[model samples]
Target: MLTMNDLKIDTVIVLDGEPFVVQTTQHVQMGRGGAILRTKLKNLISGNVLEKTFKSGDKIELAELSRTKANFLYKEGVNFHFMDNQSFEQFILSQDQIGEISNYVKDESDVEILNFKERPLAVNLPPKVDLKVTSAPPGVRGNTARGNVTKPAVLETGHTVQVPLFVEVGDLVRINTETGEYVERA
Candidate 1:
């Protein structure tokens, strides 16, 4: 159990019989009225986002989310497989549950799986991942002065990300998993 005052960003809570994670929260106090907590929450299972306000001290249900480190194995049809590094147990998650992290994860990559009441809800990749560029066009000479120019490059994981024009095949690059953006050359 939790109260509106205890709401924190990224904290999972149960509302209306569904699990939601707080994306952002602000507690506001007015001189003429009572305090309220404004929150932006995302549905853990459906991936829907909603903004709602609650009176301060209002009771809320805390969701039981468990996170475990797992090593990604492979994909079978519509499900992705992962092995628990500690228990040697395996689990398969649906593509929708993986959300954005699916784009940055590669085979044998370490990931964090978020489970709600023992059911997998989401997958979290490392903050940054190093991957090799498997395909990209050559950059024209004298393009260095271009401002933040990028070219689409396919990674070893079969995911495509925009990399600097200077990037080429076989080059190793670091990518921000959360934003699915190129960070820098590895």
Candidate 2:
């Protein structure tokens, strides 16, 4: 059990028998009445979001979650496939559940799968990943007039990211998965 004060971003709580991860939280204070907590929660099972509010002194139930190593196999249609490292069991997560993380993942990469009640709910990627630039337009001169000079480059994973003008095709670049931005050459 946890109090309203314990609610914060990334906190997992059980509500209506479903596990939800807190995406955002805010504290509100009334002039003379009690305080309250406002939160946006994402459902771990269905990938749905809900906004909820709780008053001060409210008790909440925390959800138990686990993580396991898995290998990303490939994507078939709208589903992303993975194989458990230990058990060799294969599973798939839809694009909806994967959200934007799909843009950062590479084939045959290792990742952590979040599990609840033995069910895989989501994928966790490393903060940074090295991917080869499969395609990039030639950098032209005189583009430096702008404060920042960058061009869109297509990665091996089929994701496009802005890179410095010096970047070219066949170059291995490090990307920040969280921000989907180019970090540096690998």
Candidate 3:
């Protein structure tokens, strides 16, 4: 059990029989009333978001969450597979559970999988990923003066991201996985 005062971003807690991950949390104190906690939470299994407020002393159930580093193996249709580095055991996850992280993950890439009561709920990718540009328009030499214009580029993994205009096919670039934005030329 945990109290609202102890809530932190990324903490997993059970509410109304559903596991929710804390997305954002803030402590608030009313001028004439007691303290409260304002939080934005995301449902682990359903991907639904909710805004909630709790009194500072309110008690909440702490979810049974486990995290492990795993190597992504492959994807078969709607299921993505991963191998646990420690146990060498493999687990398969549904696309909905992985959410947007699936878009930036490459085969055999290292990732952290979060499980709630032994059920996979989320996938965490590294902050930055290096990928090759599979397709991009040829860069015009005089385009440099335009100050960092961007063009859509397809990656080897089939993810499309906006890259600087100077980028071209076969060029390697670093991408911010969280935002799916181009970070820099690699």
Candidate 4:
């Protein structure tokens, strides 16, 4: 249990049976009353933002969050599937939960999954991932009139990213997962 005074940014807590990550916290003292804490929280699974205020001494359950290594299995319609490496347990997450990680993850790749109370909530990807270029358009020479020198290339995961004109099909590249940008050839 955690009291209002313990609330801080990045703290994970359970309210009304839902897990939330604290985005911001402020201790405000009303001129004539005890201090109150105003907090901005983000739903870890649903990606919702909520504003909540906790009066002094209010207590909340600290969420039980865990991360496990899982290998990407496949995607069906709106759901993505993974298998735990250790336990070999299978799990599914909707597209909403997969979110941006879909851009960098590929079939059979190992990723980290965040579980809330032992249930899968979200997928956490590394800062960089190596992917083989599936297709890249031939670079046109002397076409710098518009000053755009990069061309779109498709990766093994089917994610499209811009690569320098020199990059071509079959090249393995390291990409920044967060920004979906090309980092360098791996």
Candidate 5:
């Protein structure tokens, strides 16, 4: 059990039998009223945002969440398959559950699966991933009239990212998964 004081960003708590990740927290107190804690929570399973308020004496239940190392095998239709590193068991998760993280995932990559009560709920991707550039348009001469020149390059994973004009096909580039931006040539 957690009290209002325990509420903080990224803390997972249970409300109405659902697990929610705390996104933001604010504390407010009136002249003669008790302290109130307000929070913006994001549902781990449904990708929903909710605003909730709790009094000073309110108790919050911390969610029992776990992370397991997994190797991404492949994607079949809308399902993404993964093999648990420790248990050697395979599981599948739908595209809707993966959200934008799916764009950064590649076959045979390692990821962490977030589990609640032994059930997989979401995937945690590394902050950076290295991918090969499959296609990039030629950089035209004198294109630097706009200060810095950039071109869209298609990666092996089929994700497009803006890269410097110097980047070309067959180049391995590091990308920031959280921002979906090109980091540098690996």
Candidate 6:
């Protein structure tokens, strides 16, 4: 069993037989008293979010979760496909579950898929990914009058990031998937 102290962002807990991932948590104490936890959680099954409060020292059960290595195959219609590395079995998830995570990955990328009770719950993206700029406007030459400047650039995966003005179309850039920010030129 886990307690309020074990709660943290991304922690999964079981409540009323439903699995919820903690989205946010704040701890507060009324002087000389026990603390309370305020948390925002998202249901892993139905994709709903709600705020929950827990008293200090409260015990909660942890959900049974699993992760497996998978390779993104491709998206067909509204479904995204993956193939397990060990079992070679295929899995498909809809856009609803995939959500904004689609922005961080492209075809053939390796990823970890989190599952609950044999169902895919979420996708864990890598820390960094290399992407090629598909469209980048030309930087004004002799426009060195400005300090560091960035221009919008679209990646091959269809995600856009602001790149240094010197970046050009076809340039390969590294991006931090977690932050969706440009890290450096690859």
Instruction: Summarize candidate 1's per-residue lDDT along 75-115 as a digit string, tens digits.
Output: 88768999988899998888877867777788998889888
Model 1 worst lDDT window (10 residues): 140-149
lDDT of 6 at 13: 92
lDDT of 5 by residue, 34-107 (tens): 99998999988787899999999898999999999999999999899999999989999988778888988999
Every model's TM-score: 0.81, 0.95, 0.82, 0.82, 0.89, 0.89
- TM-score of model 5 (CA atoms): 0.89
Q: Give candidate 4's error at residue 130 in angstroms.
A: 0.6
Model 5 misplacement above 4 A: none
In the range 50-126, model 4's lDDT, one tens digit per residue, is 99999987888999889999999998887899999999999899888778889788899999998987899988899
**Candidates 3 and 5: which is better by lDDT?**
5
In candidate 4 the C-alpha lDDT for residue 32 amounts to 95
Clashes of each: 0, 0, 0, 0, 0, 0
List model 3 lDDT by residue over 54-74, tens digit each.
897789999987898999999
lDDT by residue (1-186, candidate 6, tens digit) is 998999989889998888899999999886988899999999987889999989886898899999998999999987899999989999898776778778877899899999988778788887888889999889886565776488899998888898888899999899997788999999
Instruction: Tell me the lDDT of model 6 at 107.
Output: 96
Q: After superposition, how far is residue 149 of candidate 4 from its true place, in Å?
A: 2.6
Residue 68, model 2: lDDT of: 99
lDDT of 3: 0.88
lDDT of candidate 2?
A: 0.93
Which candidate do you rate higher for lDDT, 1 or 4?
Answer: 4
Best by TM-score: 2
Q: Pairs clashing in candidate 6?
A: none
Roughly what TM-score does model 1 have, to 2 decimal places? 0.81
Which candidate model has the greater lDDT, 2 or 6?
Answer: 2
Judged by whole-model lDDT over C-alpha atoms, candidate 5 comes out at: 0.92
